[model samples]
Target: MITAENLTKRYGKTLAVDALSFSAPRGAITAFLGPNGAGKSTTMRMVMGLDRPSRGSALIDGKRVQDLPAVPRTVGAMLEMGNHQPRMSARAYLGWQAHSARLPRTRVSEVLELTGLASAARRQVGSFSLGMRQRLGIASALLGDPENLILDEPINGLDPQGVLWVRSLLTHLAAQGRTIFISSHLLAEVEAVADRIVVIGRGRLITECSMAELRERAGTRATIVSTPDAKKLVRVLREDGAQVESELSAQEVVRVFDRSASQVGEMAAEHSLRLHGLLQEKVTLEQAFMELTAGAVEFRDGGQEPSATAVPSAMSDGDPQ
Candidate 1:
């Protein structure tokens, strides 16, 4: 398992990561999430031992990353794409990493095929497209076939099919009892695969829980009622203490929050209202994430600039997508 105990980082007078604590257990996929300037990248770097923490610790299996014997064989991380030599072929690059880690060269060919880069294995890194580079990065991380994987934006440049392939690959790896910790802006995909979520904002821990727990805590369920008498229904629902909202473009549509479909239907029936359609709308991950991080956003369009103390200097909190 990957665990952080008050993991903090600071650059000069600016604090990049606060006292953040969380864990990504084995046999599960945990998604690390936050908005721009939320210090996600910095935190990941700290966990990998690439950046020293100002306080606290980042641990893998109860040991610090640097203290772990044969670190490459124990954990594999893909923090960014396109960090390889541009003149090297995909196969040659993986070979170099495998050689450095004392891993068998056969693993190079295995990961290339696993990441769907076997056909492009001989292509120079500079010639590879964005998606291909992403695949190569993942291949390099899997070169050691470590039991724990930490990937940052692994699906950034992938196409729809590529995204699906990644989803399947992560699922397959997790099923084998590997710990998969990834950070992605793709909320829908995260929702589909993540067993737990850790959300941070402004360099502090916001929330961390399982997918089901997040849905429950957010209470993201609403009922949609379509009727010709939307205006009257809205008034009645408001009088009955139901939070009602209407679609500006579709006057016939009304959304009632914190109420179930049956409850809304009964209310409509009691008021002798004609309902054209009634259905419950499940709150999506995107909606819940937005609600949970609404106040944590560091940058906003046409919003006031944050005070100097509120913004980090040396290391901007924004993840360079």
Candidate 2:
């Protein structure tokens, strides 16, 4: 398991990472999520010993990563892309990593194939596309057959197929009892793959829980109903203190909030109302994430507001006077 205890970092007067702590267990994909400038990269750097923490510790199996005797064998991290030697071929690069870690040369071939880079093994790193480069970087990380993996934006430029491959690969790795900790901006993909989620904002822990638990906290579901007795149903639902709204303009469809489909159905039966449709719209993980991090967004667009588009005073009715 990977554990972080009060890991903190500061740059000049700016506290990049606050006292943050979390644990990622083995046999599970733990997703780290945050908006831009939320200290995700800083925290990952601290964990990998690339950056020093102003205070606290990042422990891998009870020891600092820097103190690991066989660093690559214990942890494999792809913190960034485009960090490879431009002129070196993919095969040569993996061979270099293998040599540094004193691993058998055949291991390079294994990872190349495992990461679907066997065909491009002889291509120069500089000639590879962003997606191919991402694959090559992952191959380097797997070169050591480490028990833990830390990847940052691994699917940054991947196509649909590439993204699926990554999702499946992470799932397979975690199933093998390896610790998989990932940070990504792809919420839909994360929702589908992550077994646990840790969200941080402004360098502090915002919330951490299973995917199901986090959705439950969102609690903004609505019941969609299509009934012939729309007027009566709306009145009855409103009397029950449920917020009802039209689902579409000039349509019989209505959405009832703060209530479930079953509740609406039962109410309809109690009053002998004919129901054509009834369904509940559950909160999606993406919605929950947005709501949770809305206040914590560090950077926002500086564009003019909608009201700012109003006609200028000199161009208005009084201007010609």
Candidate 3:
């Protein structure tokens, strides 16, 4: 397991990382998420022993990374895919890493095939696209077949097919009981693959929990009701101690926050009102993230605030897609 115990970092007078504490457990994929300048890179650097922490420690299996024996065999990290020798071929790069780690030379080819880089093994590092470079970096990390993998934005630049491939690869790795901790800004992709998420903002930890737990804690679920007597239903729902809002397009619809579809349906039925539709709208990961990090945002444009927008409502034309 990877553990951060009150990990803090300071660059001159600026506190880059606050006293953050969390764990990336084994046999699961944990996604690290944060806004710009939220100190995600700094934390990852500390974990890899690339940067000295101002206070506290980052430990793997109860030992600091610098103190670990055979670091490559214990943990593999890929922070920057672009930081590589330009003239080296993909195969040569992995071969060098394998040699340095005292790993079998054959392992280089194994990782190449594992990362789908066997076809382009002979390609020059300088000539490969960003996506291919990412694959090469991953191949190097996996060359040692370490039990833990720490990757920062492993899908920075990739087409749809490449994205899917990376997702499948990470999921498969986690299924093999390897500890996979990744940092990404792609929330949609993260939601699809990550079993747990750690979110930080402004150098402070905001939340860390499973995706399902985070959604449940978001505390934002609404019942969307479509009926001909929208105004009457809205009044009735409010009178029943439910907060409601209305939206009128071609058809009449109302949103009852903190209420379930079943409750709304029963209430409408008791009132003898005909209902066209009823949907229980739950908070998505994107919505939960936006709400959680709203106050922690260190930088913002001169645009509307996050709180200004309502939970995306279902259109009266049809249920939410």
Candidate 4:
């Protein structure tokens, strides 16, 4: 397991990470999430021992990363993808890395194939596309055959097929009891694979919980009803303590918040209302993420503050830091 206990980092007077703490457990994929400039990279650097933490500690299996007997074999990290030599072939790069880490030369070929870069292994790094470079980076990370992996934006320059392949690979790795911790801006993909999430804002821990718990606590489930008597149904739902919004378009759809489809249907029946259709709208992961980090956004489009009501009480990890 990878654990951070009150991890903090500072650059002169600027505080990059502040009293942050979270865990990425084995056999599960944990997503590290935050808005831009929220200190996610800094925190990850501290965890990997690339940067010294000003306070607290980051541990891997109860020991510091630097203290590991074989650091590369214990934790393989891909913090960035552009650090490789441009003039070197992909195969040559992996071979050099494996040699430095005292790994078998055959392991280099294995990872090249595993990351789907075997066909491009002979190509120079400068001649490869962004997607190919990404694959090469992943191959380098897997070259050590580490038990834990930490990746930052592993899908930054991939096409749809590449993205799907990465999703499958991460899932397969986690199923083998390897700890996978990744930071990415793609909430849709994160939602699809993450078993839990650790969200931070302004370098502070906002919340950390299972995906199921996040949905149960902060997800908004709304009921959508299509009815000819939209006005009447809106009034009925409002009187029943449900927040209702009616769209008086050709379809005459009404959205009722904090109510289930069955509840809305029973209410409509009680009011003798004619309904064309009723369905429940499950809140997307993006919606929950926005609400949880509304107040923590470092930048705004129009220099406007976020709505106070945008953050729900249940979503708050604790009293604001």
Per lDDT, the best of the predicted structures is 1
Identify the runs in model 2 with alpha carbons over 4 angstroms from their true place: 248-251, 272-276, 302-321
**Number of backbone-clashing residue pairs for each candidate, in the order shown:** 2, 0, 0, 0
Model 1: per-residue lDDT, tens digit, 1-321? 999999988777777788999999999999999987888998999899998899999999888889998888889999866588999999998899999999999999899999999999899999998999999989988888898999999988999999999999999999999999999988999999999999998789989999999877766477988898888889999999999899745648999997888988888899999999998887788998898888888767888886454544333237322
lDDT against true structure, model 2: 0.84
TM-score for all models, in order of appearance: 0.89, 0.89, 0.88, 0.89
Q: Record all residue pairs in model 1 with backbone atoms less than 3 Å apart, i.e. clashing.
A: 37-317, 37-318
- Model 3 Cα RMSD, 1 decimal: 8.0
Whole-model lDDT values for every prediction: 0.88, 0.84, 0.83, 0.86
- The C-alpha local distance difference test score for the whole of candidate 3 amounts to 0.83
RMSD of each: 2.8, 8.8, 8.0, 5.7
What digit string (tens of lDDT, one per residue) describes model 2 on residues 1-321?
899999988766667778999999999999999876677888887899988999999988788998999988999999877689999999999998899889999999999999999998999999999999999889988888999999888888899999999999999999999999999888899988999999987778999898878877876578999877888888899998989997544558989988888899999999999998898898887888888888767545796342221211221110100
Better of 1 and 2 by lDDT: 1
